[model samples]
Target: MNQVIHTLLNHRSIRKFTDRKLSQEQIHTIVKSAQQASTSSNVMAYSIIGVTDQNLKNELYKVSGHTHVKNNAHMLLFCGDLHRINRLANTEDNQQTIDNNLESTEQLIVATIDAALAAQNAAIAAESMGLGICYIGSLRNDIKRVNELLELPGHVIPLFGLVIGYPDHNPEIKPRLPIDSIYHENKYKPFAEQEQFIEAYDNEMRSYYGNRSSNTKLDTWTDQMIRKFSTPTRMDVTPFVKSKNLNKR
Candidate 1:
């Protein structure tokens, strides 16, 4: 495989970081790489806020409930932004035209996808530079608080945070589902041996967790999934999204 594909396949979420800080030039290049990612219809409906302030990082750490946000060399909040587009539309056309297309589920989905793609590009670039990165989805635990802290405007939502830094610890690459289970042929095919596949994967994860150097837990992938989904998570997100005038259609 080429170096790019090799880097992509060797991805891991890094939670521990060293004391080293990324230079401004590195940060600029990484963001430039993110901007180079493909966007749906070239709308590029996303924005990134790079946070290096310790106080702000502390506040965001609490909001995220993840210490990595504060510990990392840099934290980037990727946002889905329809506000810019709305303003541009208003300037070009009229308020009525903007209003007609502002609160759409399709627009929300597109912006979110755009943000995700951009963040992934950033992550890949960081990894290629021999840096580590972690995605902080827990920032969505309290979306309203994040919105307020960041002083977000309407039609903009903080999708997730990306923490980048030098690695303090090396982590095992987590296994993924078998190729056959994920990649379908001409038509979508349901797993014929679902139980068998799951059992094998669960056993593999059980070993993985048990043998891990830190926070070793006696659990399997299925066990974790059951525990996680058994309870409602981030229920406030729906109301928060509506408050931003998104996903309303």
Candidate 2:
């Protein structure tokens, strides 16, 4: 495989980071890479907040329910932001027109997709530069608090945060589902004897967990999913989104 493809395939989430700081040139290149990602209707409805303030990072550490944020050299918060579009539209449009755009579910989805695509691009750039990254999705665990901390305006939602720094330790690559199980031919296939595939995957995961260097556990992938999804999570997301004047439709 080529160098880019090799980097993509070897991607791993790095939590433990060293004290090495990222240079301004590196940050500029990463942001430029993110801006090059495709966007729905070319709206580019996303904003990245690069945080280095110690106090702000401490607050985010609590909000994310993860301590890694405190150690990372930098944290980038990718937000699904329609506020910029609304502000631009307000220059030549009515309040009703702006509200109509911000309240639709389609617009919300578009902005979210734009932000996620941009984030992935940034991740690839970071990894290629030999920097480590871990996506902090738990930022949504307390969405309102994050908004308050960041002083975000309406029509903007914090989707997730990315922690970037030099790696303190190398981690094993996690396993994924079989190709046939995930990739369907032309037509969509549903529930086509996945028991065997799942069982095999579970065994592979069990072995992986047992052999990993740190936080080793004797559990299968299925067990982890059950523990994760069996309990309702981020239930406040819908209400919080509505409070931000998004997804009301």
Best by lDDT: 2
- How far residue 125's Cα lies from its native spot in candidate 2, in Å, is 0.4
lDDT by residue for model 2 (1-249), tens: 999999999999999998899999999999999999999989999999999898999999998778888889888999999998877755445777888878999999999999999999999999999999999999998999999999999999999999999999999999897666777789765765666778889999999999998989899978889999999999999999999899998
Name the weakest run of 10 consecutive residues (lDDT summed) in model 1: 90-99
Query: Each candidate's TM vs. the true structure?
Result: 0.95, 0.96
Off by over 4 Å in 1: 91-94, 191-193
Off by over 4 Å in 2: 90-94
lDDT scores of the candidates, listed in order: 0.89, 0.91
Clash statistics: count for each candidate: 0, 0
The candidate scoring highest on TM-score is: 2
Model 2 TM-score is 0.96
